[model samples]
Target: MKGCAFNVIIQLRELFNVEGQTVKIDDTVSAEELSALGGYEQYASDMRLLGKIANRAGVVTLSYAVSVTLRHLCDRCSEEFEREYGYELTHTLVTSLEDDGGEYEEDYILCPENALDLTELALSDLRLSLPTKILCREDCKGLCPECGKNLNEGGCDCGK
Candidate 1:
């Protein structure tokens, strides 16, 4: 398969040694790529991933933190705001070249090309890690329904 510039590809041959080793990954990937891999709302230009990947017993595990500054329109106010989010994610990877009609686990990843793509894994974790509702602030007054005014900024003519 063709690899993109931002796709995190790790060669399967790297896990040859029995002793586990740590691989550090730190990079910025575009929101479009992430959204495609996982059903995540892509409001940020790029997402940052920084953490470690370890391989043990032919299984690869990733433990990392993902950070993104998303440009979101407040759900209540409809006002634009930048929200920063940090998510810590961990996942176990499966490298399967062929399907032997065996039962597969939920987190089983089929890496037929011998190059594991971690971009999808990271995006999946991000999707699950994100909050259901994204708010600018806890005490946000939101917009006045009647006059469509930002109540957080100031009072509106539509008296409560």
Candidate 2:
């Protein structure tokens, strides 16, 4: 079976003995791959990932900012529009069970194989940052229920 495209692995061999070392990350993730992550309706062709990863002993710290254009439906007016969003994410990676008290933690990734996969980690952060409701404008008049006409565009013939 093939692995997910977003599952980019990072080898830990070079960081074992290193401490306080930071690795800069600059990469682009396709919207197709991001859509597979399954939280939003539509995404731009590509999203930019920029940030750093710091290694200290067996523990690693991952911090990065993601920027992308999102296509959303306005809840009030029912119009489709595009919006730009940028946010930062941080995660802790541990290489051993003892590092996380012999159990899984939501905020930390367990990398027992001496490698870390960033696909799910990044997706979770992005979804959490998304707003529950998206609007094209603050004062959207919505659609006239009786006439089924967009009120924001113009008034409907329906009384009241």
TM-score of each: 0.71, 0.79
TM-score of 1: 0.71
lDDT by residue (60-149, candidate 2, tens digit) is: 888888888888889977789888888887877777768566787776767777676665566667678877777887788888878878
| Best prediction by lDDT | 2
Q: Candidate 1, which segments miss by more than 4 Å at Cα?
A: 1-3, 16-21, 30-46, 96-112
Q: Summing lDDT over every window of 10 consecutive residues in candidate 1, give the lowest-scoring window.
A: 92-101
lDDT of 1 by residue, 1-160 (tens): 3336658777655753443966888877877765555443655768888987788765677678888777777777777788777888776554563343566666566666656676766666666766777767878888888888888989977765
Backbone clash tally (model 1): 0
- Winning candidate number (TM-score): 2
Error of 1 at 160 (Å): 4.9
Q: How does model 2 score by TM-score?
A: 0.79
CA lDDT, every model vs. true structure: 0.69, 0.75
